[model samples]
Target: MTTRDALKIWIVEALSALGPSTVPRIAQHIWENHEAELRQSGDLFYTWQYAMRWAGQILQNEGKLSKAGPGRTWMLI
Candidate 1:
């Protein structure tokens, strides 16, 4: 899968595991759990953070995640 696709899954996994969490915290979980995979993901190691945000938005649009308010954590729908 592409980096953004991978991030879509990871974001879901992060929220499933952590229950609503801030973007940084979700990123930390992905980094902690999938560092090896991410490092081998071509340019993703550098762009995953930005891609993660995009993935989260996509997820929200897909109804897999809730809309995030200002300074709010991401939640599953």
Candidate 2:
């Protein structure tokens, strides 16, 4: 798979592995463990955020996840 696809897989697996997390925590884990795959971000996340919002929206829409807080914490539904 390409890097973006790998990132989606990594994020899903990480969410499954850790349960739930603040976006920064998830991003930190990705940066720490998957550096090889992560080296290509080129600062896009800091500027635009990554796909976290998009994923949460899709999951929430699908009823697979829900907002856990008024802000960024999300949980499986």
Worst 10 residues of 2 by lDDT: 43-52
- lDDT of each residue in 18-61, candidate 1, tens digit only: 99899999999999999988988887778999989999999998
lDDT, candidate 2, 1-77, per-residue tens: 12354555556666777777777766776677677645556554443235656655666777777667556665655
TM-score of 1: 0.90
> Where does model 1 exceed 4 Å of error?
none
Q: lDDT scores for all predictions? A: 0.88, 0.61
Best by TM-score: 1
TM-score of each: 0.90, 0.59
Model 2 deviation from native, Cα RMSD in Å = 3.3
Candidate 2: Cα lDDT at 10: 59
